[model samples]
Target chain A: MSGSSPGSIERLLGEREIVIACGPGGVGKTTTAAAAAAIAASRLGGDVLVLTVDPARRLADALGLKGLGNQVTPVPPEVFQAAGETPLGTLSAAMLDTKQSWDALIGEHAPDEATRDRILHNPLYQNITERFIQSHDYIAMERLYELHSSGSWDLIVVDTPPTRNALDFLDAPARLADFFSSRLLRWLIAPSRSTLLGIASKPFTQVADRILGTQFLADITEFFVSLQSMYDGFVERANAVSRLLADERTSFMVVSTSETVPLREAEFFATELATRGLDIGAVVLNKVLPTSLSDPDALAATRRLAQRTPEMTAALAARLDVDASVLDRVLETVTESFEDFAVVARREASSRERFPLGGATLLTVPQLDRDVHDMEGLLTLGSYLLGS
Target chain B: MIPLAERSLIFVTGKGGVGKTSVAAGLAQMLAFQGRSVLGCEVDAKGDLAAAFEAPPSGFTPVSAGENLSLMAMDTEASLREYLKLNLKIPIIGRIGPLARAFDFVATAAPGVKEILTVGKLCYEVRERHYDTVVVDASATGHIVGQLAAPQAINELVKVGLIRSQTDWMLDILSDPRQCGLVIVTTPEEMPVAETVELAAKVAEETTVELAAVVVNRVLPERFSPRAEAVFDRLSSHEGIDALSEVLGADSASVVGAAALATTMRRSRVQHMNTLRAGLPAGTPLVLVPYLFQRADGHRATRQLALHLAEEIDR
Candidate 1:
């Protein structure tokens, strides 16, 4: 892909209202998404906001900020300036706290003041809302919709949870919603009613039964009874969150390493996204080994040394013995491994060749020597994002 | 020499993203080659173990990666379902499929339940004697500690019956130095070596499993000697140096680069080895594996790793 051209990824970003970057852990999704947003904001002269749900708070660290909560914070203009780029546009970022988001969601969805007070105050409700239902992976779409609906920026970029199946993050809102809407909630609530009725009708009998046998089960049943009202409220909010995620404004950008497992995950996540009618803007294959060797003569000399050194030659022979192939075959295999990796790189380059969305574009970032840690790394990534 | 038949559970763990899965696969293959029935288990949900065995991603069922080596990728859902069936005595899981699925999902939603379920399943495999040797490609250091400590964690939560009994038994086995062995794998780099030392200390404090040995993989071989350096220097300034220089220019850089890398690597490796030697017991051995030029993928690379491991284990 030409550095100057609007690659498939760039176009996709330009056209989509929301871009979700998803991948496995430690694959540079956060940095990549941040860079992409920075690129769109600076190069395209569009307003961009990047939202990240990783609890590690690494995104803010990457962007050279103190901390980010639910509110959008403008990235320092000096960061882009340091990278030799004038800030021709604006970029903002926010780190989503799932617990805070859940609390906000409850406050927004509560039916009445008394209901809200009762629900929010209940320990059971707090557990379900703050702990059980507040996972970043499950609430990604909620954050996306929250950012999208604000109308605060022209484009929104979301850094998804780290998982092999990126679509799982996309599917979480709906899955949680389904759990609440399903009959399981009724079952959870039922025992409470039965216990209350039994208390009203024959308290002594039930109490004696509990004391005589099944004491553990009785305690568990009592705990479930206390949680009934909160469970109902949780179900209602989960439904609302699910509906917002299934909307068409959302697009997925799968980030992965060129390694087999990561690529396979990308393929799987892509298929899952397609099944859910979510548009896969592009597959951002990260950490691809450069196709052209920096120096070829060095490779030939190393090959010659392998042929000449007794110890090295012995190691090579031992390696060949396990595989049991002829010299020609061994050379062919070695060549093919390199060629296959190049093919993967080419495929990634071509896949992002054209942005499917009219105004959006695709882009590629070459592999770097070190992991992205501080602001300098993010700036390096940012430069790559701008196709520098 | 210790007979291969007596070895029961081989717990292989390393720093995250190292070739732990590959090492586990090679170990299983080597054991299988010696006619031992082996089961290779990967606790991570990435299902790379299935990929190694060339099996589809539905990973509950064990698939044969080789003649006597079988691979199983632990699925959180399947494990939860089985746990519910066994613990709650809910037989018709299909009839209440939604509830079953919900329970499975909710159970995993709890903080450390997933780790517990994974480790619980592995313990089941070990206790059942389904394989003569079970190799666990456990989670990274932090997660592995939580995983191995699950039995104790669950013991505190659930007080009676099979779960408690099983937890007790598992803890007993893990805490016994003779029954279970913990092999810490590391690269000859500073961070991984540091992490390995910390992990070993943590394991020592929390559990009774013996620190069998440390496997330092991916060490750069020493490539230059004093004589060779002098010869290369002379060649650089010799009368016919220009022609030879043109031919060997890139090689010179490569050699220099390799030498520099080796020097730094050797220094760090020796420092780590010394630290480990001082910290660990007197008898605990350290094994160093040279970095293979090839990537750790496919059966060929796995076999090569097995050969390297054979030397280490034999010692």
Candidate 2:
């Protein structure tokens, strides 16, 4: 085991009731969340749930959530046993199904069944729930809120949606609440409710009508009117979800690769999270090259091996039972490959140095030789995460 | 399908962190290097496009990147203003702040209104034939479908309006393979390749834009032949390492380890490559860009990728 444990991460998983893994897309944030939850459940001995979005297929099967929906499925202990381990506690997972979550929200908040059905059947409603990029963010946070409030699990590790702006999901709840309670939305639903605002938005509507047409306006207006019944419920729940994120029990873990772009975005996200009074518990850098790649001795040795003098090539060939010419070529390829990867590893090292971690704990996971697609893979990754 | 570079407009997209902006800039740079006037537009205003060109940040007004390359960042607000001035003949554009807010309201409530502005602006440049090829650093895969299909969505939602009339020409350009196409950029990895394969299917089904080609970026090169690999496996033993250390007068473990790393990385990624090849339409052009060990940043790496792309397209 690596003795230099990322102690803060271990402490974070053990102590915080909620850990939200967020950062730029394709940086293994989803895997990081699952590994942390799996490790915490196995080590800390408590019920833990990882709410993920679009896990790799094999990983989903490993988690017993191949066709995940809103319902949480417990990962059977037999699956962990197959991975050659025993679970100390339950580990469950649920994938974020945005459309289903939206329908459920409407079902819960609508004034009556008829209103709910009308809103659900609206084409615009379906489009907004299904295609509105921001809605996914809002729904993920809302789902987290509902799960946290249920009091069933000791810890919940949530993987945020990959947003266009890394900060979009952070503001989604507040934005949704503001949109639902806005005077414009109110005026759109029923202009007579506010004469002053209605008079103000009239010319605006005239221009909009000319551009969007009366039919589009009527369709949109009808949709908003149908949604009016759920206004208060949405506002209250959204604000609650927003507040829940900032609660003391929750912490944010920003995940990124050591590559410059993702690292820069993760730093910005961490800074933004801090500026918003959210606690950044740790930053996990995944798929980092080995430090030895940049070692001076290794670099010098590769440089020497690159020459492939006749004496060295013949000796290497005899030792390896290959022809001298083939050995010469192999040595050349190895040296060239080493030097090439060394450049990237050094770049990663310098980028890691420049990361502005502030007070957050830093954790780095070396690049694995293969894709992590099974429970054993997850646990191996989890062990690296735990430094156990 | 039309050759990728022959298309009048190309929207380069992929999962985030997969070098979509770099590919778009590289493709545009390649065209510019060929003496064809090119415009590169960043759809999300991320500034990474400008960084790819090693130029200043772009805006609604195009910034000249080099000889024949000009880069612009898409601004939906600016696009809306331009639309109003040209289409609505609105003289008081400066004073339409309240109306803009109303537009914002509808754009939020209705999904495709904002997307149309982004697409409409790009299609406008194509329609004007202002540039030989206009390459767009478009939204990530998650949102590109919504953006590409925005015109159709508007057609369905709006019965009669100025926007209603705008979708026809855009659709004509987008649906024609020779005029407009989409290039999906991906690395040979699980999530990216999976996303690419899925997105190709979605593009075929949901949007009218032609899939010009697939650019597999950062494909790790195999440095060893089969016989050489067998030799390497034997040489990796401790006895061979001791002999190697004696010859080199230093530890050769990492030097050898780097090769092992390369081999395994290449081996794993080959599966993704095969998966990608098997999943695409029978004849989709697959372009490969080698992994750059040098920092993949600025104009130098962009040029290297462009050169690689040139070779692939010619082949």
Write down the lDDT of every candidate, Cα atoms only.
Answer: 0.60, 0.87
Give the range of the ten consecutive residues with the poorest summed lDDT in model 2 chain B. B92-101
Q: Chain B of candidate 2 versus the native chain B: what TM-score?
A: 0.98
Give the candidate number with the greatest lDDT. Answer: 2
* Cα lDDT of model 2 by residue, A288-383, tens digit: 888889888898898889865899888777866788887788788888889899999888888877887777888888899888877888888888
Off by over 4 Å in 2: A1-8, A192-201
Which lDDT tens digits does candidate 1 get at residues A1-388? 4445534455666777787787654456777888778778877767888887542334465564555467678888877777667766788888877667766766666656665666566543444444332366665667676667678788888887544344566667666666555554455446456564443233322322322223323433454444343556655545655655555666677776655545555666666666666677766656554534223564564445434434433444353232212322332333333333334445544434432333223445666655455545665776665556
B1-315: candidate 1 lDDT, tens digit per residue: 123335576678876445667767777777888788888888775767656655565377787777888888787668866765665565543545554454453353333456667777777777888888887777766456666766676565444545455576777767665556777877754446656777888877766566766777766555335443343333333322332234433233442333333344455566756766676566666767766555546777677877887876676
RMSD of 1: 8.5
RMSD of 2: 2.1
DockQ of 1: 0.15
TM-score of each: 0.70, 0.97
Best candidate, DockQ-wise?
A: 2
